[model samples]
Target: MFDSFVFMAPPLPDDLVTRYFRHCLEDSLFTLRRQVRMARMSGRFGANDETRLSLMPMILQSLLEDGIRDRLPLQRVDPEWSPETLVIAMHLYSVEARRIQSPEETRRIQQTFPDIKTPDFTSAEHTGQLREAYIAARLAALRDGTTPTSLSIGIEL
Candidate 1:
């Protein structure tokens, strides 16, 4: 006899949070890697909002840190590089890493650096416009290179 269906709770692992972060990071880094590499994408940046520019340095620092654990990021990036420059370089490095690691690499990398997904960047895209406005914010700093911007790495890279 058919009766009201009994609800079954979905399995939630003890490491669910870790697993979620891993999933998110893989998805995020994938798109960020592509967006950073798209040629002439620099033009997409507006001429103000130095606040967003801070992301450039942050991105560079992250990639450099990653390179510390793996030689790829270091080998591909120049220490004398700017944050904007680092974007492209990191994108290249990420792509290369993806290639070398096969499909299983993302999972493995998460195991090694469980916190990689913790980047504090807000969302960058919304309904149809730049969601976080990070690109616009970093624009001024990227162009002048000597502006009183907050995230400027004066020493280069």
Candidate 2:
């Protein structure tokens, strides 16, 4: 259910961002329980640990800004909200980028993902897996021919 794309994010570093992604993937309880386990084991839970990080930005943005909540499951999938995840959310918004408030926003996305290839992304599927589905569908939607059915309301203008 994680990193199901051809260009899946490369191995992350030893930082909290990477560790938290690992931790959140283990459990469906929003955050991983093992982090606290390892924290207690290692001592101090290590503020330096990314597992103690926050995804509040994605959560709020997904809810307030994007209005695409079938989006990601913070509790079920993972909640590291790493730059990669943030980018995913941005691209997901790209799926319907045309519908948001500004042309500037749409142009920004073009700038953000200039290399967003088509055929590679257009076929992304859900595989009946939530996380996998989220990633695939979002990527697919970013393809050149992809204009979410909702596009009529925005860029088609």
TM-score of 1: 0.24
- The sequence of per-residue lDDT tens digits that candidate 2 reaches over residues 57-149 is 334345343444444444423555566656555454445433433456433322333233333233223111222222232332222121223
Q: Please report the candidate that would top TM-score against the real structure.
A: 1
Model 1 root mean square deviation, Cα atoms: 16.8
Tens digits of per-residue lDDT, candidate 1, 14-129, equal 36434444454455544444444342256654533243444455543443344322334444456886787666555645554344345464334334334334342122111001
Question: At residue 33, what lDDT does model 1 achieve?
Answer: 40
Candidates in order have lDDT scores of 0.39, 0.36
Query: lDDT of candidate 1 vs native?
Result: 0.39
Off by over 4 Å in 1: 1-14, 39-42, 46-157
Per-model TM against the reference: 0.24, 0.23
Residue 20 of model 1, lDDT score = 45
